[model samples]
Target: MKDSWRRLAERLGGRLAFQAPLRELTSFRVGGPARMLARPEDVGELQELLASARRERLPFIMLGGGSNLLFDDAGFDGLVIKLGAGFAGLEGAGSLVRAGAAAASADLLAWTVARDLGGLEGLAGLPGTVGGAVAGNAGAGPEGLGRAVTRLFVLEGDGRARSIPAADLNFAYRRLEGLPERAVILEAEFALTSRPAVEIRARLAEIRERRGGQPLGGRSAGCVFKNPPSISAGRLIDECGFKGQRVGGARVSEVHANFILAENGATASDILALIDRVRQGVLARRGLALELELKVLGPGGEVRA
Candidate 1:
């Protein structure tokens, strides 16, 4: 497998690293290493790499900005493809804006706000990449990223690129459903309303202030669990007295109960254990089962709770 990856690296001629550390890549800051990490320069290279991986029968996973993910302590034994800077372009034509998959959410927000785009003001302080936001349907309150997405350009599992319109998509809470298995989002077009830049900035400021209560600079994923129905997960966890609860080096944030922070010397196991304890406590006390918002990646590239 190492030789196969080496050959693939030579053929692609992009940034490919063996035994790349996964800990530094994620916001959680608690993960092992990846067997192989590849950053493709462009869409053509990405397509070729994916096709080659498939043909070689190698397991592969796509990583965005790594804001909402938790990789296992044992690490991934497969290919980890992260889109390069070439896939981070952003452009605008009137009220419609197009952003590459790897473009940072902060950058996209800034671009739209500068152009007086009103719709994305709700996503002001969101982390991760555009592709991750679109895939997870990231949002602030009732407004989701999918609401602004008009069309998406994706590289399918079969190596075919397709343009999918919003009408054909199924945008649910905290997730974008009905995408083809292994489909990779290349770029997305968002339709936004025209507004004064000052007004947009004001809205953004308001959101930032509201988000000030969260542990912004902490070593943690944004949220640990999704709100159930009309209830807030943080409120429930707080009521359950899980705040400041510690499991090894992972502790529930004192500022926000929904976030589990990783302190120095934290491991993936510590975080996972804390998450389980909090979930059980919430369920036992509140009688409501909270769903996880954090994506836990196992050693085999499978998604865990």
Candidate 2:
């Protein structure tokens, strides 16, 4: 396997590593190392890397800003591909904005606001890249990134590149459905509205202020669970007296119950255990199962509990 990986790295020209540490790459700061890590410069490089991985029969997964992900302590045993600086392009033409999947959500939001694009102000303080946000349908309240997206460019699992229109996309609460297996989003175009720059900045400021109460200073993966229909997940957890609750180095944020903060020396297992405890508590007391908004991944990129 190491020989295969070495050959693959040589074929792709460089920017590859063996047993790369993943804890610092994520917001939670608790993951282990990935067996192989690849940083692809552009779409062409990404496609080549993907095809090579397929031919080599090596598992692969994409890593964006690593904001809402939880990698297991054992780490991923496959190729972890992260987009490089070449994929972070952002530009706007009229009310239509084009952004690379690697572009930061905050950067995209700022670009839109500078051009008086009103729709993306809601993404002002959101972490992660534009692709991750769109993939997860990230939002504040009922509004989401999908609503602003008009088109998407993706490299599908079978090494085919295609553009999908918003009309054909299926976006749900906290998730985008119907994407082809192993597809990677390369770029997205958003249809925004023309608004005054002052108004856009004010709206952005308001949204940022609203998120101020979240435990921003701590190491957290933002919200831990998705809000149940008509109810806030944070409120539910707070009602269950889970604020400041701790399990090992992981603790529920007192500022916001939905956030689970990781202290120094926290392990991915600690976070997972705390998540299970909270889920069981919420289920036992409220009779409602809190669904996770945070994505948890095992060593093989499989979803973990």
Candidate 3:
């Protein structure tokens, strides 16, 4: 199987990411390595790669900027495809902004704001790529990314390209729960409001400052658990007295219980175990089970159980 993939890579003139360490790609700096990492130069290349993987029945993952993800220590054994140059641009005018999937969320938001776009300001400081943001329908306060998304261009699981509308797209709290797992977001067109660039810039700065007030920016996924209706996950964890709890190298952030920090040789397993403890603590004390916002991918190239 490895030889076949290698031959394919050679034919395509694309480099392979063999035993690529997930720790290096993620914000947490944890997780095991992936068996293969493939970066496609264009959408055609991506589709061809997916077709080959499907034909070979090889399991694979579509990796974005690796911000809102937790990978296990076992490492993935399948292919990991990360989009590049072709899917990392920003260009648009009027009330619509066209952004590439691999574009950083911060950069996309900034681009929109520079044009005086108002809708994306709510998501100013969110991490990850535009594709990840769209896939997760990421948001802050009472707004979500989907609210601004008018149309999405996606590479389907069947190696086909199609356009989907916001009405047809399904989204939930921190989850682009409805899009087919096999589909890859290529670019997204957001319908936003025009405002003064200065005002938009100020709003962006304000939100950045707000996120700065939280326990973010460490080697950790942005927010570990999603807030339940009418309750914040961080508050619940803090109320449970689980803040600053440590297990091995993983520590629940004292500043924000929802954030689990890794220090001094923290492993993916440590973070996973700490997550379990936090969830258990919250459930035991508040009788409320919290859901994780970060997608936990296991080693051996499988989604976390």
**Which segments of candidate 2 are over 4 A away from where they belong?**
2-4, 11-14
Among all windows of ten consecutive residues in candidate 3, which has the lowest summed lDDT?
296-305
Pairs that clash in candidate 2:
none
Which structure is stronger by TM-score: 1 or 3? Answer: 1
Cα lDDT listed for each candidate: 0.89, 0.88, 0.82
**lDDT by residue (tens digit), candidate 1, 220-269:** 99889998987889989999999999989999999999999999889999
Q: Point out where model 1 deviates above 4 Å.
A: 2-4, 12-14
Worst 10 residues of 1 by lDDT: 1-10
Q: Write the per-residue lDDT of candidate 2 for residues 1-305, one digit (tens) a residue.
A: 55756776787666888889998889998888998889988777788778778987778888898999999999998889899988889988889989999999989988887777889876877889998999999977666889888999999977799999988888888899878889999999999999999988787788889999888899998898999887899999999999999989999999999999999888999999999999999999989988889999988889753
From the highest TM-score down, the ranking of the candidates is 1, 2, 3
Alpha-carbon TM-score of each model against the true structure: 0.97, 0.96, 0.95
Q: Select the stronger candidate by lDDT from 2 and 3.
A: 2
